[model samples]
Structure formats: C-alpha cells, structure tokens
Target: MTPPEAALDTRGTKPPAVLSCPQITTLRHRADFLRAARALRQGTQGMLVQARCRRDNDPTIRVGYTCSKKIGNAVTRNRAKRRLRSVAAEVLTEKARPGWDYVLVGRPGVTVNRDYTDLLGDLNYALRKLHAGQDQ
Candidate 1:
C-alpha cells in the first residue's frame, strides 16, 4: 500500500511558517529566566506578563511561553501555547523593544477564548505598563 500524500503542499504558504518566528521557546537557561524575573521589567493583566528587557548580543527580542498542568490537558495546553506564540509574534514584531526578551505565562481561564485582537491589545498594554514602571 502507498502512503497518503499531504493534502496541501508546504510551498504554497507565505514566508513565515507558524513556528519560524523563533521568539516563542521555553525559558531553558535558569540564569536568563532569573534575570528576566528579577532585573527585567514586567507588566500584567488578567493573563500574565508581556515583558521586555535589553540583553547584550541579543539583537532581536525573543519570547518564551508557559502553561502549567493546572491549565488543562495536552490538547488545551497545546492550543494555549499556539495562541500565545501567535500573540508573541504580533507583540515582538509591532510593540516590543528590539533588544528585549518576552515570556508569556498563561493564566487559568479564557486564555484560549480571548479575542486575537484583544490579546494583542493586552500585550501592548502590558508592555506599556512595564515601560511605565521602569520610569518610576
């Protein structure tokens, strides 16, 4: 028996494959995340953070995503990660400072249900709040 071919060829898509932005990764290095948690400025809403900071040699801002087991099952966690990644792309591309890194930690409710535009707005608002906090 022959193997089935994919329904849609990969080439037809636009420049960015869903995962290529590279901003959304787990916060692997303990020190980096610690620095982000400590020295880095932060902002929050009903969700979690939309944070930013400058790092030497890191020319572009990167993002890390998280959702604890309490959030849901595997399918729900994956969906939340995807939504956060998409939002992080919009935040990094548009509002985020160039030399910063972001880490978006998901809250318990509505993370998957929130409107995309509103998610973007929350990210923007959070970044602005973080910056404002920096000034004072």
Candidate 2:
C-alpha cells in the first residue's frame, strides 16, 4: 500500500461548537449580560423563551444556541447550532443591546434550507414581538 494521502476531509465528522446558548436565569445574571430580551424574543414563533429582569455591565450580550438530539445525530445537532451561532454573530453583533443574555432553541423545521437573511429576519420579527409584550 502507498502512503496515506492528505486532503480536505469533507466526510470527517463536524465538531461541536464551543459557544452555546446557556439557559438564562435571574441568579445567573451578571454585570455583563447583554439585553437582547427585547429584541431576540418572539412569542408568535411558538418557541420556548425565558428571560431575567436583571441587567449586567458587559457591553455585549452573551448568546448560545441549542439543538436537541431529537433533531438528529451529533453531527446534525452541532451543525444546526453552529449555523445559529454564525448568524447570531453576523446579525446580532451590533444589533443586540448590552447587559442581556440570549439563547436560541432550534425547532424541528429550523434546520431546513434557509438563508442567513431569513434567519435574521425571523430573529428581528421575534424580537419585535417580545418587545411588544413588554409594553403591555
């Protein structure tokens, strides 16, 4: 047999992301939580969303994304969360306010062939809905 060849292993298993959308709670609220509650939330989306009223001193919000094993195997779940994280960084970087913690949970249909713009739009819409509830 010849020496092993080196190439981009597209077939290689994808790795889980280092960033995760951690569950937000009142006790966990620190000085640096970024306030995306008003923006990253949308009740109409029919997704589970919980928020804390406390504020933090950090200038940027900490965000995490989760995909349960039900979504698929380790690879599928990791891919979904990674996509969410990339979109979060691209669109929510400057958009999300400081002092709040945000997390996004993937729905069954969330992993479809959707574009980043569509994801961002959904996020924006949800955020508006969340803020509307705050007004009432």
Candidate 3:
C-alpha cells in the first residue's frame, strides 16, 4: 500500500478527492429562530424540536440550539447546549431536509443526562411527528 502522503498528489497537479458529508449551516439570528418557533413543534423526553420550511430555494439545512436559564446556571446551560449540538451534528447531517430550519430546545433536567441513543431517537421521532402534522 502507498503511504498516506503519497495518496495526495499535491504538486500543482489535480488534488485527491476528499469524501465529506454535505455542509449544514447554523442559524445565528434571533429572527430565524423565531420563525422556526412559529412553525411545527414536537416535544420529547429530552428536547423540544421546532422546524420551519423556508420559501426561498436555498438547499442547505440550518439548525439552532438553545437552552433556557431554567435548565440551570451558565455552566449547566452551556453543557446542555453542547450536548444538543452534538446530537444535531449526528442526526441532522443525514436526516434533516434541505431548505428547512430546525431549533432544538434542551430540556432542563433530562437533556444533560439522557442516553445518546435515546436522544437520537427522540430527534428522529420529533421530526417525523412535525412533518406528519404538516400533512394534516
């Protein structure tokens, strides 16, 4: 087998192909999060998920994560947000639809302690529920 560096012919020649997942951007503005809040929502044991489909034809998935003060002090809230971010990175990269915005609200006591697999399932279930509601 060739060495790792040999795999990349980076001498002004064509670069080796890099395999990567599609890019997913974050929702930074308050207005974007508010817009999702006005759309469909589903709550689970660990989180509340809100999703909104945008009218524009952008083909990128946007996500936001929030943990209220009710969750705890700054440190605890930060920890919850971190966990929410990880879950989003794992679940949304594959499951989320493009041209949509999603907001994941962290639960006070459960978000930081819930099992990772359960959290993933909760997000999947919530998204399905939200979409199903829109069909009605």
> lDDT of each structure?
0.68, 0.54, 0.88
Worst ten-residue run, lDDT, model 3? 127-136
Backbone clash count for every predicted candidate, in the order shown: 1, 17, 0
Residue 34's lDDT in candidate 1: 59
lDDT of 1 by residue, 97-133 (tens): 6567667877667677788888888878787777774
Q: Which ten residues in a row have the lowest lDDT in candidate 1?
A: 16-25
Q: Which parts of model 1 are misplaced by more than 4 Å?
A: 1-28, 40-46, 50-52, 55-57, 133-136
Ranking by lDDT: 3, 1, 2
Best by lDDT: 3
Q: What would you estimate as the lDDT of candidate 1? A: 0.68
The sequence of per-residue lDDT tens digits that candidate 2 reaches over residues 14-126 is 64446543332222343323343443444423233333333445444556566677778887777777776676666555455455556666665555346667776767665
| Pairs that clash in candidate 3 | none
Which stretches of model 2 miss by more than 4 angstroms? 1-53, 133-136
TM-score comparison, 2 vs 3, better candidate: 3
